[model samples]
Target chain A: MNDLMIKASDVGKAFGDRQALDGVSIAVPRGTVLGLLGHNGAGKTTLVNVLTTMLPPDRGTAEVAGFDVVREAHQVRSRIGLTGQFAAVDEGLSGLDNLVLIARLLGASTREARARAAELLELFDLVDAAKRPSRTYSGGMRRRLDLAASLVGHPEVIFLDEPTTGLDPAARLGLWEVVERLVTDGTTVLLTTQYLDEADRLADSITVLAQGRVVATGTSAELKAQVGQRSVTVTLADRSDLPKAQEALERAGLHPVPAADTLTAPVTSSRELAVVVRALDEVGLEATELALGEPTLDDVYLTLAAHAA
Target chain B: MTTTLTAPRTRWRGTDVFTQVLVLTQRSLRTLVSDPRMIVFSVLQPLVMLTLFSQIFASIANTPGFPTGVSYIDFLMPAILVNTAIQSALQAGVGLVTDMKNGVLARFRSLPIRVGSVLVARSLSDLVRTAAQLVLMMLFAIVIFGFSPAGGVGGVLAALALSLAVGWGLGWVFLAIASWLRNAELMQTVGFLAMFPLMFASSAYVPVGALPGWLQAVANVNPLTYAVDAARALCLAHPVTGVVSALTISAALGLVGWVFAVRGFRRPL
Candidate 1:
């Protein structure tokens, strides 16, 4: 309990007739990342707002860094930093001035604030643009500056709400690397992302939300396992060979479903690909193409949605 | 980068509210100064008013029942300052709405600083900005328009201070409106609607007695009338009763605005 940096129990929130969050709960331990995976309108931002003390829950409670969000909001605020969905830097101020302002507001002396600003500017590779107003920065630069501003206080826990939502692939990768570095430095993180690959890459555990409820929660591997097997598909050279191929695969203890000139069979792992090839070769059946498919976060969502309905 | 990550955490003693307000005020002031165009436009509107009103209404001072032996510019100077204060105060709400739309206010909310600091800093910075605009207008009046007040420099300072007090009080009103509306365009529309009627109906442009019966009744009850009349008294060395009335009204207005603004600000976005 003491090691958990973020803990929320049965948190619920509603706006008018709409339930933005309903009985959602999650816990993230110290120095680990909790990936909140959800689509739009899935209560991702609402929960972030609650845990960050920007909004109180309609029911239940939450705690961050050992402080209750509602009762000890100031304590929670002091221990956490939030980079909201939108980049929240002062566009009118220079990048350096923006960072220095945060540091000063957190009670740093003039020299100390400047020093921290300079350090963050160098770290985020904004040294060249330090004196330019943040509005002049590119999208990637602005997001970086926003993240750097949140880090000015050296917060114990960081909430990044879709930190790379609009970035190109290269920029997304750059931000991912930054998050990875922060995790390495022993900071706890709660990241909300619509991208499964992002969650798979960053989160120690993933919580999937749909329609303001937690539809699933587990390690990425565990969630993938729940969605079931990887599949192998083989396209035959001739339609006549399909029956023989199916028979061969069946004898090899594989279930192959055939359609037209193709046979697709679910397999536990990639190693089963060799089994299909060897079995088909024994019957002199040639294949034009062979492919393997891994169950993705999309499959998990579809499966969950199907189950819910 | 590693050094910063590994740097020992500073003990989380809370920041003094005064320091927080000062720092946030500095941020607002810095943003204002960096935008030369904004400063230019803010001053230009009132300068145009000063020019147009002093020229067009210069003859009214010689009319029946009007105060004699003083140029219309002197009479109009204090009123213009009051009007300028009103315009500048409207920006307080507009600025807050801009911050809300741009997400800076959201970031500020997530920080550990006292929530009231944001509102206080907003009004304080706008007051400083209003002071700058008023001083420039005063200099323009003295140098360009050959305007001289009978109450001398001390009275001029008192008038300027009174205008600022009115602006500060009104600043909170707009801030409260911004907090409730949370839409910059809507806030501007509402601010203009409230401001125009108050400005025109007051004694700022013409003596309340010279107005139609209905408008004079409205002007008599309008807070701006008291503010403008009080500022005019300070400028021309009239009785102190209007000044006392204006200050008390402003203080009451400030108290009410502060309560509602804080409540509205605390509402979840």
Candidate 2:
């Protein structure tokens, strides 16, 4: 509890008849990134709101940076920064003005605020577009500015709610790099994203939410190992060789599923590749292509989603 | 590279509410002035009203019950100021709704600042905007129409101050509405519905005595009527009869509005 930057226990929230978050618990330690992955309406934003002190949970408690969210909300707020699902910058003001306004709100003097704003603009590579209204900024520039605005207070903990939801691939990668730099600087982060690749790359640990419940939680490799499988697929040179290839693989104690001209078999080890080769040779069958594949985070996500459904 | 995360966690000493309000008011004012077209249109509406009403109703000044020595422009100018104040006050609500919709207010909420500061800053900024517009409209009335109030510069200044106070008071009402509704389009529709009747059915267009009996009752009870009537008296150098009632009503409305606005704003978005 002392080392944890964010901790929530049995948190619950509801809106009328729909439960937005129910009995959800998560703990993120200091100086690490916790990736929260969920589908739309899967209670991602609701949990972010609760932990960031924007909304009080209907049941249970949450603590951020050692302050109880409900009882010591201002203390929690002072130590945390939040970049909401939207850019959340004042579109009518220039990027510089937006950062300056936040800095001043956080009790920085005008000179200090300007200095901090300039530093963040430089860090985020937004110095060139700093004088323009955020409304005129590209989506990526706007997001960078929003993130910079959140960084003005040098908060120990940050909550980024779907930070790259609408960004292009390059922009998403740029933001991921920024998060990596922040984590290196010892800032704890709770990032919510829909992209599994994003989670796999950035998260020290991932929590998958489904219908206001924690469906799964683990590291990327651990999750992939849970539902993911390694396999070998062989494409036949001739369409007529599919049946022979299937029979040859079955004789080697491998169950092959044939689709089109390819036979795919789940394998426990890489030695099964030689087994497949020798089996094909014994049947006098020639293969066009043979490839081994590793399970990806996508498989883990799909399997979890299917099970949750 | 400046590393911030390892920096010592400073104990939270509460930020001054006044400073927070001032900082946010500057932000609101910056957004207001950044768009020249919005400023132009804000004054344009009253300029159009001044042109249409002063010309069309110029004959009313010569009628039997009309004030003998005052031109229609002089009497109409003060009422137009009050009307502009009402419109500007409604804009305060619209501005809050826009912030709420665009997520800026959410950012403010997640910060450590006092919640009431947002409402206060909104009202203060809109009051400043209304002041600028009123000054420009007054200059237009004096220069373009060659209109001079009988009460002179001091009287006109007093009327301007009264209109600003009234506008600031009325702004709280709309701010409360904005906090409760949290929808820009709905705020506009409701604003129009409320403002249209309040502006026309009061003493803004004509004297209460000149109105029909039913509308006269409305004009009598309407707080805006007192505001308009007081402003008209100050501009026309009358005995200043309506000042007490106008100030009292504005204070009462402001008190009620502040309570509700703060309550609504403090609730979860």
Candidate 3:
């Protein structure tokens, strides 16, 4: 019931000459998800490693579930479960056996371990394939089994490192639903991912990392707002009318950028949708398609990437 | 799913380290059991070597100063037994490296279990496997090669115990190296590189006098030579100071290796 289940303060780690994490600090409150967004080698996994006590920070301190990760690693470890980018379950063992082994290691009795394994198999939709070796399982199935393994001990906080990185859309949604359920039941989560939409949908707040530093941290709406505003996109009836449309929009104090046949301009609000219509009408042009589009996480990501570069 | 109680909370209970090590040992033994072919092949290689070497070196017993009381196979059996045990110990390092490479060791580290359990469990299970291989080789020496020791079955059992002790000690040394290297091929290369000299310079195949001046010096101090000499003495029904020294060295090596192995586990991956 701690308010902040995970907190890192000025954490720094370096490998050889390269800094994998530099002054990276993040706080994840209880019963909330902190979505870590970053490009490859952006220290997302490195941060996860530090928080989970897999690696200690070179300069600063990190704590999970109120236990200092380096000094009280055992306590931190017992409270947090980590599912890496790749499934780390024992592939040679059956899914059931894998869960049972984890449960047993977590201090469950033999009978309790069997019961818990059976229960997790059903919950993860892996009951039918429970008896089959995980090596034979599909990618999605193996991923679920890995998640199930982590949950065998009912960890208070879960660190999912790109949990849905390679899953099909359906599998990703299924996994997301499982995560949503866990959060609803009050489990803290720190999820690192390459998918912006996954963060937008699942995260209570997002922290964007670039070059091992926190470039931005906010709610999805806040991040999107920081990048820009809701925009109006216009598609003209004639393809050659693109320049005229762009000029008309620009003349009305709108910044227009042409992408293929469409011209889009950022607007402070949906009220500018009328300005777009009026400008086009004043130029004696008709629009085939005109719509106001809200700024998405993708725009925020692109803007961050541009700023970092 | 509804019937299941997903508390979504950590109980924070602690399991004893002894139970954790025992559970992990069970896992290692289970994996070893599942791969019967590996065990069979491991034992088979020593059987082949024993047979080939006994036949090839039978003529060496006719040399002027060779031990007169026993067939060449009797002397060679103790050497092969030690060799087999050393070979089996290599598996400990290889298994640890494989575990590290596959992230299984990482998974274990993430848990609340004791850090040393992984190495201790591997060494324990390997000791059992090496013991089985030693016994199988001893039976082959007795039945197929017409080999008989003056010390009888008790002496044979004593030799088996000594070989296993030596192998267990060496296995920890390799496991320590594996934790640092985290590469199976590299571990095997280093282990064999070190093992060859130890085996070749030891009193396994011949007396220390049969070696050259420098090698005789090396063979005199080689730990494997003491182990083989002790086992050979036991088999000849005249257990000597060599037996006491061998057991003491094995115990000491096991302790030192264990400390290094645990320290290796404590180091970051």
**What iRMS does model 1 reach?**
1.6
* lDDT tens digits by residue: candidate 2, B1-269: 75453243443333789999999999999998898677679888889999999999999898877888888999899999998888888889999989988889998987898888998899888988999989998999999987798899999999999999998888899999999999988988998998889888899887778899999998888888999989999999998999888888888888899999999988788
Using TM-score, give the best candidate's number: 1
Tens digits of per-residue lDDT, candidate 2, A1-309, equal: 379999999999999999999999999999999999888899999999999888889998999999999999988888888998788899999999999998888888888789888888888889999899899998889889988888888889999999988888898888888888889878899999887788889999999887899989999878766654667889888988898888888889876767777887766678889999999999898788998877543345445644554
Q: What tens digits encode model 3's per-residue C-alpha lDDT throughout A152-186?
A: 88888999999998899999999899899989778
Better model by lDDT: candidate 2 vs candidate 3: 2
Q: Please give the clash total of every predicted structure, in order.
A: 0, 0, 0
Instruction: Indicate the worst ten consecutive residues by lDDT in candidate 1 chain A.
Output: A297-306
Best by lDDT: 1
Whole-model Cα lDDT per candidate?
A: 0.88, 0.87, 0.84
Q: Is the docking of candidate 1 incorrect, acceptable, medium or high quality?
A: acceptable
DockQ, computed on Cα atoms, for candidate 1: 0.41
Task: Score candidate 1 by lDDT.
Answer: 0.88
Query: Model 2: residues >4 Å from true position, as ranges?
Result: A230-309, B1-14
* Model 3 agreement with the true structure over B29-85: per-residue lDDT tens digits: 777776677788898988998989899989878876677877889888988888999
Backbone clashes in model 1, listed as residue pairs: none
After best superposition, candidate 2 residue A249: deviation in angstroms? 22
Candidate 1 C-alpha lDDT tens digits along A158-273: 99999998999998998898888888878899999998889999999999988789999999888888766677789988888899998999899876777667887767778999
Q: Check candidate 3 and list the clashing pairs.
A: none
